[model samples]
Target: MSKELLKGNVAIAEAALRAGLQAYFGYPITPQTELLEHLSKRMIELDRVFLQAESEVAAINMVYGAACTGVRVMSSSSSPGVSLMQEGLSYIAGSELPCVIVDIMRGGPGLGNILPSQGDYFQVTRSAGHGDYRPIVLAPASVQEAIDFTVLAFDLADKYRHLVLVVADGLIGLMMEPCELPPFQPVRTTRPDWALTGADERERNVITSIYLKGEEMEGYNIKTQERLATIRATEQRWVEHLTDDCDLLIVGYGTAGRIAYTAIDEARSKGLRVGLLRPQTLYPFPEQRVAELAEQVERLLVVEMNAGQMLEDVKLAVAGRAPVDFFGRMGGMVPMPDEIVSAIDESFAKMAQPA
Candidate 1:
């Protein structure tokens, strides 16, 4: 494998190209603009399709159209821009199209800032569009993870015949890091026989998640939940650092995960047995793994770019077995290693005191 230094956005574009993506439809959004730019230039040279759509809404619908044609298609946007694409995302999910979406998260509630933030955690993993459907969400903490997950997103989308989202932050999208290029692969244009191509000699196939009757809808929901259970069993992934002998467990993802790593290292140097649990797949959330770690640690601290969004998941995983604490930096403000370390110290002190 050839190693090259690349920005996370460019690496993701390259990964898509190597994964044999045929089309890329997206709008310009801050912190993720480079991804579109890189793909736009490369697609033309590679004789592929790349369209800078008018808006995120148009871009997502464009993805829907291209995906319906059995071509590999992808789109990306930031938080506010992703919110605009929710309707289309819901359509893609409902239609059961195999496509990838990249959310290089930025601070948001409205037009929040352009800096990196994990505030989009709940939006991407829990709710962004409407519905009871869950998209496979992959969280990448570093630039390398961003590239790796972008390719994996395509595979998972196709394997499950569902939408897969690469939920990254601006830091992972814009930071420069060394990445190994993946081997080239041929694009597969032929979809499953079940796919909704145009009606011809065979019977027409209707691809939709809508069910008119309550019983039918209930059946669909049951199937979806079963699939989710399968995903949870087979796809949960995470990384542990110094956990074998730790008393404190830090839980984080995306850039905040990297920050928490540093904090964990610093605390270890000070003779505090602090470990880290970084979730890679946010949806099939590694809940069982977190619960296992909770059993071993005395206290669990959840660090994130949002105020207590991931913390809720940690609490659910621990189920009151351990004291769960939270540390967050919102509105595009990232917490430094010192701040994380301080939070760990404060949490430890609180645990040591009487109730």
Candidate 2:
């Protein structure tokens, strides 16, 4: 294994190649353009397919096409570009195409800005692509996690035959850190007997999400829901820090999660019993863990880069078992450690009852 200091986007690209990803389709977008460039340069040397599609829509559809061929494929974009790709994302979900889509999220809600933002939380976790489906959403907090999650994303996508999204922020994408590159894994080109790959011995398989009859769609939805339930039960992942004897728990993900870590450490140094609960998998959210923590902590503070988007999930998890409060910095502004610590202090103060 070679050790190198790499940016998060480059780490993801390298990880994808190591994980046996054979195809990459994407359009240039800020914060994630390095990912496309890195993959474009490396894929050619590896004799892999790398297409700079004309648009985000085209890129996602290209992922759809390549994925249908049973190839390990991926695409990535920032928030606005990802928004444009939603139509194809919806199609990918409906057709059960196994591919990974990375969103190095930037400020959004319509061409907002090209800075790190967690505004896409609801979009990714809730499957905002106009469908009753859920994509396995992985939120990476550091550059190392970015690499690890990219590999995990592919495995999960292929295992479940569904779309998996690596939902990171621009900060995580742009930051540099030491990363140990994993050895290249052999590509799996053998399609399952069930995958759509131009029938050789069996009948032609048609992959689609369109069911003309309402009853058929309802049945599909039920199956999808059951699968999601199983995933939630077995796949929820999170990282806890200093939670064993804490009065306040700070919850966040991605870059915000890292920032919260610093805040939690600072609060502990100052003699405050503060902890952190960082959800690594945002979709198969660690709701049960948060609920269990709620019983131990007096207050739970949800800190995010958006205006309380993740706070909703935190509150839902706590479910009145603990007082949940939100602290956010919007429009791509990330909160410093002091700001987050102050938020935690304020939350605890509010939770302190009057005599």
**Highest lDDT against the true fold, candidate:** 2
Residue 261 lDDT, candidate 2, scale 0-100: 91
Q: Model 2: how far is 112 from its true place, Å?
A: 1.4
Candidate 2 has its poorest 10 consecutive residues by lDDT at 189-198
Tens digits of lDDT, candidate 1, 294-328: 88888989999988888888888899999988899
The TM-scores, one per candidate, come to 0.97, 0.98
Q: lDDT per model, in order?
A: 0.88, 0.90
Tens-digit lDDT track for model 2 on 1-355? 6678999999999999999999999999998999999999999999999999999989988898888888899999999998998889989888877889999999878989989999999998888499899899999998889999999999999888888999898899999998887789998868866577778778998888799999998998888888898889989999999999989988989888899999888888888899899999998999999999999988888889998887888888899998888889999998999999899789878877662
Error of 2 at 126 (Å): 0.6
Candidate 1, lDDT over the whole model: 0.88
